[model samples]
Target chain A: MQRALTLAALALAIAFPMAAVPLDLDFYIGFASRVMIYAIAATSLNLILGYGGMVSFGHAAFFGTGAYVVAIAMTHGIDSLWVSWPLAMLVSGIVALGIGAISLRTRGVYFIMITLAFAQMMFFVFIGLKAYGGEEGLNMPHRSVIGLGLNLKNDATFYYVVLTVLVATLYLLRRLIDARFGRVVEAIRENEARMETIGFSTYRYKLTCFVIAGMVCGLAGALIANQTRYVNPNLMHWIVSGDMMIMIILGGLGYRFGGVLGAIVMLVLDEAISPYTTYSKIVIGFVLLAVVLFAPRGLAGLFDRKRVRAGGGHG
Target chain B: MNSATRMTEPVLEVRALCKRFGGLVATDQVSLDVRPGEVHALIGPNGAGKTTLVHQLSGTLPPDSGSILFRGDDVTHLAANARVLRGLVRSYQITSIFRQHSVLDNVALAVQARSGSSFRFWRPVRDESALFDEARAVLARVGLADRADVLAANLAHGEQRQLEVGLAVATRPAMLLLDEPMAGMGPEESERLIPLIDGLRKDVSILLIEHDMDAVFRLADRISVLVSGRVIATGTPDDIRANADVKRAYLGDELEAASGGEA
Candidate 1:
């Protein structure tokens, strides 16, 4: 049934160019593209935080490195999409690997603080970079394009591409989590010591997950760069890391579909609340706190048939 | 006893291992040997340092001073997990398992660890026939093949203990360190566990730590007694039973009262 739903979504996405929703307005497409990008980032964070039991708060460093990869490559006059996007991913993966190797050496509150510190350090490096826009930011002359004849400058065209990538990425993530690797990560989450005593090397597995997450989040950063045509130190801010954490918690920690719903709900909330008053921050904050306290399992807990049946048929 | 190289040599040899926590000495100069496929029981009273010895042998704690040789390799300083990978598996006194997962998933993880390469990110655990087959076989061996789909946390305490043993066995390790498998069990459960543990002696070497004297006497080929961080005695169950100092340590009056009260 999930496969069919995914297939239907894919079919609709493929036919979307032909059956355009008619919301080609720059504002609507832009909002959607940004949400899709953030979805990628949130999904990656959830892989480690929710499933693997590694509460890393420095995911923004990788997110920013991804953005920097594109900005740095373009600043050097390398406009080729092929060259920039892959390098962006590689650099982010390497950074995550290095940071994860060190930060994951500790556990509990120490783990969270270590990850946050590493991300803050990265943020500072970007602030210190007078060569790239320093405190302001950097902008790309043109968006990335495939070698094909299609122009990526078209807002509608790029929005659809972002959507396709989001869907495919989610599909790949689902596959990865259901595999033997996923089982082991869940085992670690459930009982790290038990897994270790059974002859499994846990640190290596966590590092591997950290790298995969970084690699995926980097791709999201590449998309974000193209969407805005800009890169800035703000991309690596502690607030951005907090945003990803909020998304994971609000959606549902361990639910595969929670990350996607989290991104969508957060985006929608931001868009809606900002118009009501300047007090939008108060409302978002309370809603987030409520979710963490009252509904920790999040939206997917409501949707899971197993959970529903087990939860006295509440669904 | 000098079957040095082949099957006769001990799989694990411990010598004068000591661990101290602040002013209290947890394990003091404990020494023992575990021959291959032999059930070696370490019996001691509360705070007698049996667990401290197990921790040192399992690599969870570093010995203040001493050495551990597993299969003739000096593994005294290896990390707990590294020691586990080297085939020293320990079962906790309080059953530590993945509570949310099905029993089959719990054991399958053990099999997956041994089969090498958990990097296959597309194959479902249930669909991995090789893992499922081995998991089922292990559950069967531990008398839990029927509860494969049941969540581990939801199991009765006895069944969870059985699964814990199954997990240690599924690793197919050269030695198992069982830390009081009968700790909280009722008589019916303890009765059930003894044969299962006795049956394990046919294949697996065990460093059995227990407070249940009868179970220890029934199951151990050889016995070591710990008294306040030190090995006070090492002998067969009969030798241990005949020792006057061992009786003094456990209290002869308490033993007589217990036997009188039970009868």
Candidate 2:
């Protein structure tokens, strides 16, 4: 069921290929790419929080780590996309391991608070870097190139790269969620005590999941840095974590495709509402409040009974 | 089917087991032995500490005192999960299970745990044919093969109890702890359950705790009666039923019929 959903989403992505001639099409395509990136990050959280029953509030550390990797590598007279991309992923994975080792010891609300503290510490360090544009941020002199055949600076080329990577990630993540490891995580979510009696060291499983989530979030961070062509301490702020949570909530926390739909809806609303009034933050806050209060399960619950419709099946 | 063919070495031996809760002594100096493929029943009234002994044997709770030997190794302070690896699986009395998971997934998870390296991420266990075969076989054993895809939360209470035992059996443990598995069941449910449990004794050593005296006497080849944190008697069902102290502690008037008394 999850596989079919990923394939359908992939088909939609390929058939609509966003880099074509229509100017407005480019805007929607760009909107979708951003949405896909957020969905990727949010989905990683769902893997741990929703499935593994872990609630982490400091995921921005991995995000920032990824961004820093790309930014730092690019500024050092190196514009090699091939090198920086994987390097960024590896760095994020390491950061996740370091943070997860300590933070996973704390359970429930304590886990959230500890994760938040780690993220803040990292954010403050980034802000303190006087050479790397400090608190303001840094503009990339050039986009990283894979050399030989690829010209990444072209908006069309980069958009498709982001799109392709997003689809592949969704495929891998969907498979991971349905696997035996995924079952254990979900089982842990359902009943850790019962799991223990059956002979599973739940802590090992949780840490493994925590690292996977962090590594994936790191990949999303790299994509975001590319889209903006900039890096800043703001990327690692707790508010960003809050934004990811909001996206997941609006989509319905555990609804697979609903998470993607939520990111699209939120970004589109932000864009639309900002034009009507300058107080977009206030409007976004009100919209979020309404979604939480009136739509407890978010937009997906609006179609609670209408599950398995024509739009997509088994997502 | 016979106890003589069971493990030549005892699967578990409790040496002076004791569990204390501040002012209360839950399980006091209880020593017992369970051999593989044999049925050893632990029977007592409510608060006789049968459940406490089960907890300590399963390693969910470390004994406040005394060592537990399983398969010739001392597993006194081992974690609940570690004992499970050594083939000591236990089912809860409360019918606890992962309700949100499909019946297949629940059993598959236990299979995965027993399969070793439950952290394997590259391949899906559901795709593994061996896992499917094992889950189906265990579910079939509990007479739940038809409901493999059903959500456990939606199952009837008795069906849930069956699945609970089915889950323990899936792990292929050397010894099984069935803790008051028939509690709150109607007569028909009990009729179905006894055969399910009886079938299990053929494969594994079972230590069953039950409040139902009839079921205890019927299933247990050897019965141990516990009272006020101590084992008052350890003998065959006929011997336990005839003991004067065991009569006063539990069964009371019911003991007379089991003893074949004229009164």
Candidate with top TM-score is: 1
Q: For each candidate, give its TM-score against the true structure.
A: 0.95, 0.89
Listed for each candidate, the true contacts retained, as a fraction, are 0.82, 0.71
Query: Quick one: best DockQ, which candidate?
Result: 1
Scored against the native two-chain complex, candidate 2 gets a DockQ of 0.47
lDDT of 2 by residue, B148-212 (tens): 98877778888888888988998898899999889888768887889888898887899999866
Off by over 4 Å in 2: A1-21, A24-32, A278-282, A285-315, B1-6, B120-126, B253-263
In the order shown, the candidates' DockQ scores are 0.60, 0.47
Tens digit of per-residue lDDT, candidate 1, span B88-175: 9899887888787789988988999989789888877667798889989999989998999998878999999999899999998889
lDDT of 1 by residue, A196-246 (tens): 888888899999999999998998998899989999989999899999988
Q: Write the per-residue lDDT of candidate 2 for residues A1-315, one digit (tens) a residue.
A: 556755786777775644344545665666666777887888777777755767788877888888888988888976687788888889988888888899988888999999999999999999999899899888887777767787877666666787777667667767777777877887787788888988898888888889888888898888888878899999999998877777777876556555566777778888888878888778778878899888876676675663322121110
Q: Kindly list the interface RMSD, in angstroms, of each predicted candidate in the order they appear.
A: 5.2, 5.9
Candidate 1: true interface contacts recovered: 0.82
**lDDT score of model 1?**
0.85
